[model samples]
Target: MTRTPEIAILGGGIGGLAAAAFLRRTGLPSTIYEQASELREIGAGLVMAPNVARLLRRLGVLEELAHHVVRLEIGWEFRRWQDGTVLSAENLAEACERLYGEHTYTARRSDLLAALRKSVPDDSVRLGKRCVAVIENGDRPALRFDDGEVAEADIVIGADGIHSVVRRVIADSIEATYSGLCAFRTLVPAEHAPEIARRNAHTLWLGPGHHLVHYPISAGKLINLVAIAPAGDYSVESWTARASIEEFLAEFDGWDPRLLDLIRAAETPGRWALLDRTPLRHWSRGPVTLLGDAAHPMFPFFGQGAAQAVEDAAVLAQCLAAQPDDPVNALQNYESLRIPRTTRLQEVSHGRSRINHLPDGPEQQARDKAFSDSDPLVDSAWIYEYDADTVPPFHIDTVAR
Candidate 1:
């Protein structure tokens, strides 16, 4: 940009709020525009992985998140569906501290969003400002909000989300392929969740073409349940759509009774379609760019969706701080630095569910046996150890490409 870029971030989601907070650490004055009139969490719970908590600690919100969310100490448990047998055990607490110097956390989405919003200025975030399209130019990019208000900035970040306007402006029109699976999510009271299964660990029950995963959130007051099942049609996608509990548990009929109990505890879960997107060729155009789900929307299979967005915010801030005078170069550096890592993660998360939800048969047993030699901690080392505080020189070398 010709002048010192006045940063304007679009979206008030977790990533956008984190972006504002991370930018504050870099001494850059930025504003966030959100479509919602009020700042609140839309979803139920989010897994605050080690990398995410470590990044928050750098942003100075560790104590706050720990105060509201359950500090997950036990590792995750992966088990067989028909006959309950230990398929894999992950020592999450030890693995994270050893790799990234923090423990993984499971907290309500509202708590994390609230903490991040607290870190930024109240006036800096303008709610109810729906963004329509971004107009890119030589250096400055202008944003036209739906309310007929036009705003311009040296760098306009499209943190808006999966259906991002900035992304449409930068990359070609990529389609979101329905994964033929609908996820039912709800937050249950930890007290009501069968006492035997209400532990701090993330418990996974793998079945035929489906799975159930739940963990403690809201300081153990609430447990977040996510049930994934194959569907004939995923024509609708909404986070607040009402779901039928009876219909949802039908998929888990042959699975263990424990899985059914989790479903029963949920009052009325929301039906969300699993939409997958192809990796974009570029994430930036001139001084305008994309972040969070706008840049990369990974499947929830890896449990790194929010974590990756947080990583994006932190790294974007780092790049801008590293090159304050050159907004265009810094934005380009941000894309080059992140494209490979995010793209690889997106691909990895895209189709890994097949292993978890093996169709019950000899194939299922063989698949389970194959994972016996795999190490969850070691296999996911690349994802869990990712850091944004420091920038290595051409670590993946996408800039040279």
Candidate 2:
């Protein structure tokens, strides 16, 4: 690895852009081939956990991101659905920074994407170059796009996403399994939302067979609301699918009045079926590897989807820079370092759904009692305190090819 590898990344999403930004730090540049004609994120909100913020600080985009995010003073508040009885709340403002070395915040998905995009050079991203196929030729891999263009590179990284086109080259196609649940997401104007919803706290209302979460985003200009319930027969999984406000309200009938008021404040909401996939045992083959959702697609119960993607970008960059001369071994090293952690998160996230949606009974009572006694920030210390930049890489006996 005397000369820097010619890196090519498929997908211009957060993971892809972050990878390119991090690689640039090590004197490696990558070209991103995106399927979309324009670069934009879906209209939603995401939690900027400490693990993500620490990396953004290193990437030199934390100040830019701060402009669009609402720093949480209090968060992880869980309440009973009927009377809004407080179950548990964490004082994130004081504990988060003191314990994790970074503060927790929430932001619009588009704003976060924009902040990451600023770190990458404009010319490096080639939009509308939808990758249709990935071909492996000896040590070099080539990507075929929809517009009849073929590009080859010393390394190919698949940040494409869950239905990634590049993944077929490394492993067999695995269908995404539906979790028999659906989520309704909407952005309520802060002016119309209740005082409780406008606060800088992430709140969750748990009830029998359903749960709802809400928090302010876009610098407190809007409140992001997510309601999860049984899917019944509906099973569409697109992010842009629409559902009426009335339909969204019907799902939470007979709940607390304050919760109902918050629902009434929302406009047309997007509804999507929740899907899960088994973690891949291997994510590298030759000079190509997968990142983010392209490697492990999990339920969103833990709100770690975006955080994990940023972590993957950091670790991948570190591995490649450490093993400069051997790109193949670098890719394998990245896979080995990342798989075990992400797989554990995937399982834990999937298990949280059942805990949050238990039927009202002795089991539910036991869960509530447990929640009241536990501190969320302390419980998640392992996830928050991880610094991918400083982590040492470990080797396995063999990596599947």
Candidates in order have lDDT scores of 0.81, 0.90
C-alpha-based local distance difference test score of model 2: 0.90
Give per-residue CA lDDT, model 1, range 1-401, as digits (tens).
Answer: 33556899999999899989998888887999999989876788888877788898877777777678877766557788876687877777677687667788888888889888888998899999988888876667888988899998888888988778888788888888878887888888776778646888887778888888888888888888887888677657677787788887787887777667777887688888888788887888777888989999887887888888898898899888777777666778888878899899899877777877777889888877766767876677788777777754222333422
Model 1: which residue pairs collide? none
TM-score of 2: 0.97
Off by over 4 Å in 2: 394-401
Candidate with the greatest lDDT versus the true structure: 2
Tell me the TM-score of model 1. 0.95
The true-versus-predicted C-alpha distance at residue 383 of model 2, in Å, is 1.0
Tell me the lDDT of model 2 at 4: 78
